[model samples]
Target: MRRDRIAAIVGIAESDIGVTPDKTVLQLQAQAAVRALTDAGLHTRDVQALFCAGAWTTWTNLMLAEYLGIQPIYTDSTNIGGSSFEAHVGHAVAGIQAGLFEVALIVYGSTQRSQRLRGKVPGEVSLTEQYEAPFGLPVPVGAYAMAAMRHMYEYGTRPEQLAEVAVAARQWAMQNPRAFARDPLSVEDVLASRMICEPLHLYDCCLVTDGGGAIVVTSERVARQCRHKPIWVLGHAETHTHHTLLSMPDVTSTGAAVTGPRAMAMAGIRHDDVDVAEIYDSFTITVIVTLEALGFCQQGEGGAFVSGGRIAPGGSFPMNTNGGGLSYCHPGMYGIFLLIEAALQLRGDAGMRQVPNAQIALVHGTGVQLSSSATVVLGRD
Candidate 1:
């Protein structure tokens, strides 16, 4: 396969980003799809492929394509939780490379927080749930909390170090109008926030909002005529270590360790070559472990890598510049938001959260219990 045919992202947008109760799931997806099409100055007829991770409905890819009145030549519905969108990007690139599709639309939407907002978990019938749910694994928060505890125990990481991540996210959120939690935060403030689970404060967790996002991908031949400057899909990879927390190889490590190197190698770049990063932050622990797993630092050094505001604004490297799922909107699966933020940075349209002259971006997504992972390297060069 030729690498030069990797798809380019020409259009991206998030519709009804926060607290959208009145909108239906399809409405949210359609609004975002239309906006992204408008952003690229293209029409639905131009979309040769469609992909979606619709958590709310079945046949989501077909449904969205029908709603948009687009008869796609190809489609994908690879539901790998939050990393689905990143995986869709990888599939679209491959499809484009193989001449299977000329243009593709990847979209996501969720009403998990608005209409059905309650203590609803992933139900009691998944393959992994069969094994873990019997023991009441607390689904997600408790699982992540355990990871935090282990990380702290193994690396001597302090709660203050984790607090810094929330504090820095807020600092970035203050500049993003679409962020769900923009109030200024401090390490002490995070420390003082009500504890959701041991070692993981409420501030350390992501927001529960109703929102949706969409991205339009196209081949190099077609992207040249698009409206925005093309953001190249340089390289990408995805993997998952386990289906349940108990099955996870190690709480301190994730699939990013493998996918990161694979992606960078395909992109022909090193860690230092990345100008910005948009990593999943379902919880502060996710960021810490993922950073270490992705080779940003040695294992267990993630606590110190983010210490003293290295990931905050005006720091050596800006992370989750969209306020992340921590301060920004986390409407169930948050992988799509990571891609949108990276595209914004590469396009020099990030406004106050922009990293100056950001040429390359590393976007990584993690799913439930860190069971699913995906990494993508995007560049303007």
Candidate 2:
């Protein structure tokens, strides 16, 4: 692939996040779409392509297109769990690069918190259910816990090292007013918190919150007309290994090991070039394992790398500046918020929580407990 920027994110927004009981999933999507389009200084009529995904409905893209009242030339609703939206960014970039569309809108929303739908098992009846569901492994958390256990046994990862991930996220959340659990958190607090699945505590797990987020992508020509500086989509890749934990080739590793390097190679950059990162923190172990897979540190060194507040607000490598799914709004699918916050930092619009001189941002998303991975390298010119 050519190293030139194929597409740029022009606008980003979040709609009524954190316990939005009054809003339906579609309403939340519409709100985010409108706000994002407004932020881009564009109108609904300008959206030439539409992309969306959610747990509420399978026909999310069709419904969102109708709701937004636009007949886009291109559409996609590729749902590969929480990393769906990050993959959507890659899809939009390809469409724009191929001259299929000029303006692409990606949106996501969920009411899992309001509907009391937490801990629900995967809806389909398949081999995944037959192999893992019979043991009553708590849908996603159990899978992550098993991975954490393997990481601990193999690398000697300690409880405090895992707790450090939660504490660091909370430290960043305290600075973000929109974060759901902004209360002060510490390593001791994480350790003391009730353990949901063995090894993974309540604090280590991500919050179940109602939220919506949006991003606007366009070609370099269209980006110049938008409201904010163009956050270029320099490189991207998505891949999945398994849907069930048992099928995963290595619980201690993820597909990120493949996607991360591929994305950076495509972007023509080095690991040191990333000024900021928005890594998916579905669980503390997810961050630890992913950091290693993404080549941020040597394999199994994730524990020490994230220790001593290394990824906190003022840390050498500022990450998840919007508090991440662990502290900020998760909304079931957290990939969209990763893009939203990355764009904010690249545009220099992330107040208080901004990473100073953040020129390049790397956004990574994990789906369904180490099942899928998507990495995007973004930068501002």
Best by TM-score: 2
Give the clash count for each candidate.
0, 0
The lowest-lDDT stretch of 10 consecutive residues in candidate 1 is: 117-126
- Per lDDT, the best of the predicted structures is 2
Tens-digit lDDT string for candidate 1 (73-118): 9989999888889888989998988889888998998877878753
For all predictions, the C-alpha RMSD in Å is 1.7, 1.4
Per-residue accuracy of model 2 over 324-379 as CA lDDT, tens digit each: 99998888989999999999999898898989889899999999868889999999
Stretches of candidate 2 exceeding 4 Å from the true structure: 121-124
Note the Cα lDDT for every prediction shown: 0.89, 0.91
Cα-lDDT of candidate 1: 0.89
lDDT of 1 at 36: 92
